[model samples]
Target: MKPLSRVLSRTLFYLLVIFVVVYSVFPFYWAVISSFKPSGALFAADPSFLPLPFTLEHYKSVFLQANFGRNLLNSLLVAGGATLLSLVLGVLAAYALGRLPFPPRNAVLYLVLAMTMFPQISVLGGLFMLLRQAGLFNTHLGLILSYLLFTLPFTVWVLVGYFRGLPRELEEAAYVDGATPLQTLLRIMLPLTGPGLVTTGLLSFIAAWNEYLFALTFTVGDAVKTVPPAIASFGGATPFEIPWGSIMAASVAVTVP
Candidate 1:
C-alpha cells in the first residue's frame, strides 16, 4: 500500500506539470495551426489540431502585401546590433565592478540599477528630441541605442553576478604569466563564461526584437521599422479585423529560431 501510494503521488505530480505545460503552449500551438490552415478552415465551427488542408498562402500574402520580410530584416539588424553592443559593454562594466575596486563602485552600480527601473515613458520625449537633434531618428543606430535602454541594465546585473562567482585566482595567475588585464579577460575569463554570455545575449536580442514603442515612435519608414510595429499597422477600428492567419504566419516567421 505504501509503494502504491508513492506511485500515485508521482503520477499526479507528472500530470500537474503536463497540464501546466499544455496551458502555456496551447495558444502558440493554436496560432501555428491556424497560420497553416485555409481561411475557411481557420474559421470553422470545430477546428482540428492537425492541418487538414495546409497552405502557404498566408505566409506568401504577408511577404508580398504586408512587406513583412523587410520588417523582419530590420528587426534582425536592430536586435543583433543592440545585443552585440550591450554584451560587449555589459561584460566590460561587469568585469570592472566585479574585479576592480574603483571609487564609488557600489554607488555607481546602485544609480545604474535605479535608472534601469525608471519608467521608459518618462524619458521617451527627451530621447526623441535628442535623437532628432542628432539626426539619428528613423535610423538603425537610434533603434539599437533605444533598445540598449532595455537590454543593458539587466545585462550588466546578470554579468556582474556571473563575474563575481568566477575565481579571481585565474586572473592572478594570468597576471603572473605577464598577461595584461585585457588579454586575460579576452582569453581566459570570457571563454569560461560562454553559457552565461550566450543566455544573456539571446535574451537581449529577443527583447530588442520584440520592442514596439520605441520603434513606432522613432521610425517613419518601413526601411527602419521593426516587426512588432509593422504588425500593429494591421490593427484597425470599426470592425476592421486583422488577417489573423497572415498575422500568425508573420509571428511564426519572426519567432521561429
Candidate 2:
C-alpha cells in the first residue's frame, strides 16, 4: 500500500509539471510552426501541428514588404537605451537609498514604490504635454523618457532589496581599508551584485520592448516606430482582408529574441 501511494504521488507530480510546461510553451510553439506554413495551409480544413510543406513566403513578406527589419532595429534601440539609462540611475539611487543612513529613508522608499502604482493613462496627457514642450515629441528620446516612469521604479525597488541583502561586513572592510563611499560602491558592492544587476536590467529591457501605449502615443513616423505599434499597424491590400499569415510571421520573428 505504501509503495503504491508513493508511485501515485510521483506520477501526479510529473503529470502536473508536464501540463504546466505545455500550457506555458505551447502558444509560442504554435506561433513558430504557423509562421512557416503557407497562407493557404493556415486556413485549411485540418491544420497540422507541424509545418508540413513549409514555406518562407510569410517571412519574405514581413521583411521585404512590411519592412519589419527597420521596426526591429527601432525596438532594439529603444529597449537598449531605456535599460542602460534605467540601470545607471537606478543603481546610483538604490545604493544611496539602501546603504546610506538618512532621515525619512523609509518614507522615501515608500514614495518611490507609490509612484509605480499610478496608472499610465493617468499620466499620459501630462507626459505628452511635457514632451511637446521639451521638443521631444515623436522622438526616440521621448519614448525612452516615458518608459522610465515604470522602469525606474522597478529597477530601483529590485536593486534596493538586493543591496539590503548584501553583508555590511564587506562595506565595513572596504572602509577599514581607507576606501571612500564611491570606491566601495564601485569596487566592492557593484562587483558582488552582478546577478541582481542582470535580473533588473533584463526585466527593464523586456518592459520597454513590450510597451505599447507610450510607444504609440510618443512616435508617429515609421522611422521611429517600435515593434509593438508597427505590428499593430500592419494592414492588407483590401480594407476587409486581414493578413494573418504575415502578422503571425512578424510576431514569431519579434518573439524569437
Candidate 3:
C-alpha cells in the first residue's frame, strides 16, 4: 500500500510538471510551425501538427517588404540599453537601500514597488509630452528612457533583496581591508550577486522587448519601431485581408532571440 501511494504521487507530480510546461510552451511552438505554413495551409480548417508545405515566403516578405530587419535591430538596441541601464542604476540603488543603514528604507522600497503597480497607460500621455518637449520623440533613446520607468523600479526592487541577502561579514571584512564602499560593491559584493543580476537583467530585457504601448506611442517610423508594434502593423494587399503568416514569422523571429 505504501509503495503504491509513493508511485502514484510521483506519477502525479511528473504529470503536473509536463502539463505546466506544455501549457506554457505550446503557443510559441504553434507560432513557429505556423510561420512556415503557407496561406492555404494556414487557413485550412484542419491544420497539421507540422506545416504540410513548409515555406519561407513569410520570412521573405517580412525582411524584403516590411523592413522588419531594421525593426529587429532597433528592438535589440532599446531592450539591451534598457537592461544595461537598469542593471547599473539598480545595483547602486540596491547597495544603498539594502546595505547602508538608513531611516525610511522600507518606505523607499515600498514606494519603488508601488511604482510598478501603476498602469502604464496612466503615465503614457505625460511621458509623450515629456519626450516631445525634450526632443526625444520617435527615437531609440526615448524608448530606452521610457522603458526605465517600469524596468528600473522592478530591477531595483529585485536587486535590493539580493543585496540585502549578502552576509554583513563580507562588507565588514572589505572595510577592514581599507576598501571604500564603491570598491567593496564592485570587487566584493557585486561579484557575489551574479545570479540576481542575470535574473533581473533578463526580465528587464524581456519587458522592454515585449513592450508595445510605449513603443507604438513614442516611435513614429518603422525605423525606430520594436518587434511588437512592427508585428502589429503588418498588412496584406487588400484592406480586408490580415497577414497572419507574416505576423507569425515576425513573432518567431523575435522569439528566437
Candidate 4:
C-alpha cells in the first residue's frame, strides 16, 4: 500500500508539472499559429491549432506598413543602453554599499529598497516634467534614462547582495598587490559576480522592453517609438476593427527573443 501511494504521488507531481508547462506555453503557441492564419480564418467560429490555411500577409503587413523595424531597433537601443548603464552603476554602488565600512550603510540600503516599492505611475508625472525640462522627451535617450529609474534600483539591490557574499580575503589579497578599489572590483570582484550581472542585466532589459505607460507617455510618434506602443498604435481600416493578426505577428516577434 505504501509503494502504491508513493507511485500515485509521483504520477500526480508529473501531471502537475505537465499542466503548468502547458498553461505557460499555450498562449505563445496560439499566437504563433494565429499570426500565420489568413484573415478569414482568424475569426472563424472554429479555430485551429494548426495554421491550416497559412499566409505571410500579416507578418508582411507588420514589416511593410508599420515602421516596425525601426520600432524594434528603438527597443533594442533603449533596453541595451539601460542594461549597460544599470550594470556599470550597480556594480560601483554595490561595492561601496556592500564592502565599505561607512556609516549610514544600512540606512542607504533600506532607502534603495524603498525606491522600488513606489509605483511607476506615482512617479510618471514628475519624470515626464523632468524629461521635458531636460529636452530628453520623445527620444530613445529619454526612454533609456526613464527606464534606469526602475532598473537601476533593482540592479543595485540585487548586486549588493551578490557583492556581500564574496570573501573578504580576496579583497585583502588584491590590496596586498597594491590594487585600488576600482581595480579590485574590476579584476577580483566583478568576475565572481558574473552570474549576478547576467541575471540583473537580463531583468533590466526585459523591464525596459515591456514598459508601456512610460514608453507611450514619453514618446509622441512612431518615428521614435518602441515595440509596445508601436504595436498598440496598429489598427485596421476602421476604428471598430483591430489588426489582430498583425498584433499576433508582432507579439510573437518580440516574444521569441
TM-score of 4: 0.98
Please rank every candidate by TM-score, starting with the best: 4, 2, 3, 1
lDDT of every model, 2 decimals: 0.88, 0.92, 0.94, 0.94
Candidate 2 lDDT over residue span 120-188, tens digit each: 999999999999999999888888989999999999999999889999999999999999999999999
Backbone N/Cα/C clashes per model: 0, 0, 0, 0
lDDT of 4: 0.94
lDDT of 1: 0.88
Reference-based TM-score of each model: 0.93, 0.97, 0.96, 0.98
Estimate the TM-score for candidate 2.
0.97
Candidate 3, residues 88-137: lDDT per residue as tens digits? 99999999999999999999999999999989999999999999999999
The true-versus-predicted C-alpha distance at residue 143 of model 2, in Å, is 0.7
Best by TM-score: 4
Candidates 2 and 3, the one with greater lDDT = 3
Better of 1 and 3 by TM-score: 3
Best of the two (1, 4) by lDDT? 4
Model 3 Cα shift for residue 109 (angstroms): 1.0
How big is the positional error of residue 216 in model 4, measured in Å on the Cα after superposition? 0.3
Q: What is the lDDT of residue 242 in candidate 2?
A: 79
